[model samples]
Every structure is written in C-alpha cells, then in structure tokens.
Target: MSDKKIITVFCATGAQGGAVARALSKDPDLHVRAVTRDVNTQKADKLKSLGVELVQCNTSNPASVRDALSGADGCFIVTHTDFGKQNSFEMEVHEGRQIADACKAMRVGSVVFSTQRSSRVLGLQTRHMDAKAEIETYMHDLDLPLTCVMVPCYYEQFMGLFKPEKIDNNKYILEIPMGTTPMHLIALDDMGVVVRQIFNNWQTFIDKTIGICGDVLTIRDVAAILTQVLRPKTFADKPLTVNDYRNKKDFPGVSDWANLFTFRMRVDQIFNIHHTKMIHPQMKSFEEWARENADTLHNVL
Candidate 1:
C-alpha cells in the first residue's frame, strides 16, 4: 500500500475545485482524488490524465459524500448556490452540511472550505453569501479540523457577469456598485495555490478562518487597468449606486449582489491581501491579470 496522503477534491470539474485538484496533483507526497457528479466529461478526463482518481459524487446525498471522503487525509470543498434554481439557498446549505458531516464521520485530517462573509451578520440579506457563512458555522459546530478560506470577487468575472457594456464608438462602461470602496479580487487559479499551501501545513490552519485576496482596487482603478492593458478599447467606470444596480432587470441575483457590494463597502478587511501574498508570493494584481487575459477580453469585447 502507498503511504502518500490522500486529498479529496469536490466539484473537481468546476473552476475553484479544478484549480485545487490540478495544484495538488503535482505534489509527489499527496494523492488527489477528484469527485464530480459525472466522471465521463472532458474535464474529468483531463484530471484522470493527470493521474488523479475520479469518483462520481452527488453532494446532496450523504452516502455519496461519505463514500468520496472515505480514507481522505484532506479535502477541498466549494459549494455553489445554484442561483435561478428553486430554493437555491436551502439546497446550498444542505449540501454543505452533508459534506461537513461526512468529513467528520470519515475523520478527515484537514478540510479546506471556500466560503464568504455573511451579509446577514451585518443585518444585510445576501442569500448566496449567507448560505456559505451558514455552512462555515455548521462545520464549526461539527468540530472538524477545518480551514475556512473566504474568497473575494473573482477576477474572471470580467469575462462574464461583470463584462463592460458597449454603448457605441468603441467605448464601454463598467457598472460595478462600489462607490469608492476598493473591491477585493482574486484569480480562481490563485485560490488553488493558497489551498495547496494550507494543505501542505494543515496543522496550523485547523479551525482558522482565512480570507484570501490577490488585489484590492476601486471600480475606476479596474477600468483604468482595462483601458491601459486593452488599449484602443476605452473602458469607463459608471457611477452606479446599489439602488440603481438592484433595479437592473437584465439578470437574476441583482439585489443580492447589490446588498453584497453594500456590505463590502461598509465592512473593512473581508480579505487579507498581505497575508495571501505571504502564502502565494506570485499572486496576480488586477493590472497583471488584465494584461494576461487581454486576448480573451478582446475576444469577449
């Protein structure tokens, strides 16, 4: 029997979990067990090609969660709110609790859970954020050896939800609801780096709540960086208020996001950029990330 440590990664086909799986797969001392709902997908195949073990799992089912976590020395978890689905918040919380319970039953040495600040803690209502917070609390109640890593806004949002709207004349407007507060941002891949370090030194992170960030910049600063990197395509930050943002009917979760932005503005130090840099020295700044993803940005534009 191999003596290498086993690390199970849930949602291994998705962005956050995939990053952790890829990073941990490279370590000679740890064996990566990737869990997904389906193991036949192209993404799962890629992980399989990396010599990672793939297990089919349904987070809602306690039996599946336990089976996947069995014999795991450590695990990385990221549960989605599944917005637009019915009862997303309850479903998310349920899945999280089920996983946490299984981790305890299996006696996993370490569990790294990606979570967010609870807007409800500040008397605000953002269901997705609060759901993660509730899960973090549940894990605490379970008394599992856990490391709660809170991630800020993803830098990758520029490619999708937060993409600037083009109005005409090659000019675009970025509409983020932060008036003057610097928004914390991090690349999903960078999360993998941080989580790997945590697993490498698991004993120190037990029962710790760590907020990780790569860069902190205002919406205007983000626009400036986009303009500088993707020159010839000017981007401007629109002075949008939370009220105005919530009123937008183009997509779902607008109000929740509005409340989240309000909470971030009012609350300070949700994420720690300095400490995150100490963990992963090569974390990317907004400008650096913009430069690196310029080609993709141009394609999207």
Candidate 2:
C-alpha cells in the first residue's frame, strides 16, 4: 500500500481541477482523488491511467461531495459559474457552500479554493465574481485550513476572443476593449503550479487571499507580440468601447463582462504585477505564451 496524503480535486476533467489533478498526481508526497460527474470520458480515462483515483462527484450533490472528501487529507475546490445552465449565481454559491460544508465535515487539513478578486472592491455586482466572493466568506467562517486564489483574465482568451483575423494580405486585427490600460492574465496551467506551491507551503498561505497573474499588457502590446510571432503578418489592435461591449449581441454575458472590464480599469492599481511575480516566479509573459502556442494561434485565425 502506498503511504501518501490524499488530496481531493473537484472538476477533475475540467480546466482548473484538471490542472491541479495532473500536477498533484506527479508528486510523490500526495495522492490525487480526481472527482468528476462522469467517469467514462477520455480526460477521466487519461487521469486514471496516471494512477489517479477516480471518484464520481457532482458539486450540486452534497452527498457525493461528502463521499469524495472522506479520508482525504486536503482538497482543491473550484466552482464553475460559466457552464451551460450553471451560470446562475445562486447555483454557484450553493455548490460552493456544499463543497465547503463537506470539507469542514471531513476535517481536511489544507484547501486552496479558486476564487476571483472581490467585486465589492470595484463597487459593482458581477454574478460570477460575486458568487466566488460569497463562497470565500463561507469558507473563511469554517474552521478548516484554507487559502483563496484569485485569478485574473486567462492568457488563452486571445486564442478565441482576440484571435487575430486576416483583414487584407498579411494585415490582421485583434479586437478587445481597454485601449492602453494594462490587463492582467494568467495561464490556465500555471494555476496548477501555484496551487501546488500553496499546498507545499500551507502555513504561509493560511487565511490569505492571493491573486496570480502571468503578465500585464495592453492589447496593443499583445498585438505587437502576435505580429512578431506570426511574422509577415502585421496586426492592428482594435479597441471595443464599453458601450459596444455591453451591447455586443454575439457575446453572452455582455453586461457582466462590461461591468468587469470597467471595474478592472477603475481599480487598475490592485493587480500588482511585481508582487504576483514574486509568488509565482515561473509565470509566463504574453510573449512567452504566444511563442509557445504560435501554431495554435495561427490556426485559430
């Protein structure tokens, strides 16, 4: 029998949880209990092959969560508010509380909850961010060891939302809001590395709320880098006005995102790049992420 501390990772097949599950599964000091609603999927199969124990658990079901947390020494909890029909803020908060309640009951030693920076800081109410803020409060009131990680915009957003399009010949356009204001971004994979660091240094992170960002750059800066990577292809940064973003029909959650971006611009001083870099030195810059995913970036457009 292997003697390793069990770490229950919820959403084991999705982005956040999958990253943690993959990272922890490689560690000799911990065992990963990968929880997913379905176990027959390809991602779950791949994780199982890596010696990760698969546990079927739905965040909506408290009993399932309790079963997954049983005998686990630690947990990495994350609730999704973007999935189809799961976008309800109430639903997200309910699921989060269920997970936290289970964690408290299990007496888990270490927990790193994936949350977003407070919406209250900007004096606005964003459903997704507000849900996380509520969950953070619930977790804080619990007696269990916990740490909250607030992530900024994802670096991968460029692959879809800001994908460069060929306008004419080699000229391309990457459109987004925030004309020159720096936007913070983080690699989805880097979240796993940071969570691992938190678990390894549990005492240092207790009750502390930390925000992680891979890079801070304006859309123009990002366009410049994309031009260099996809050479012979010059790109232009097209600024989308807040009014336009709020009314953009093609995008769902336009109002929420509009509020978020507006608030981000208002409180630009809070997402300190220097301090975030100090915590996760391995964080990648936009250029680094661009170069690594060059082929994929090119294919998107």
Q: Identify the leading candidate in terms of lDDT.
A: 1
Q: In model 1, what lDDT does residue 61 have?
A: 90
Which residue pairs does candidate 2 place in steric collision? Answer: none
Which residue pairs in candidate 1 have backbone atoms (N, alpha carbon, C) closer than 3 angstroms, thus clashing?
none
Query: Candidate 1 versus the native: TM-score?
Result: 0.96
**Model 1 per-residue lDDT tens digits across residues 49-150:** 999999999898999999999899999999977778768889999999999999999999899999988888688878889999899999999988889999
lDDT of 2 at 295: 89
Model 1 per-residue lDDT at 223: 90
Model 1 lDDT at residue 45:
98
lDDT of 2: 0.82
TM-score of each: 0.96, 0.92
Error of 1 at 259 (Å): 1.2
300 Cα displacement, candidate 2 (Å) = 2.3
Q: Indicate the residue-level lDDT of 113 in model 1.
A: 96
Q: At residue 235, what lDDT does model 1 achieve?
A: 92
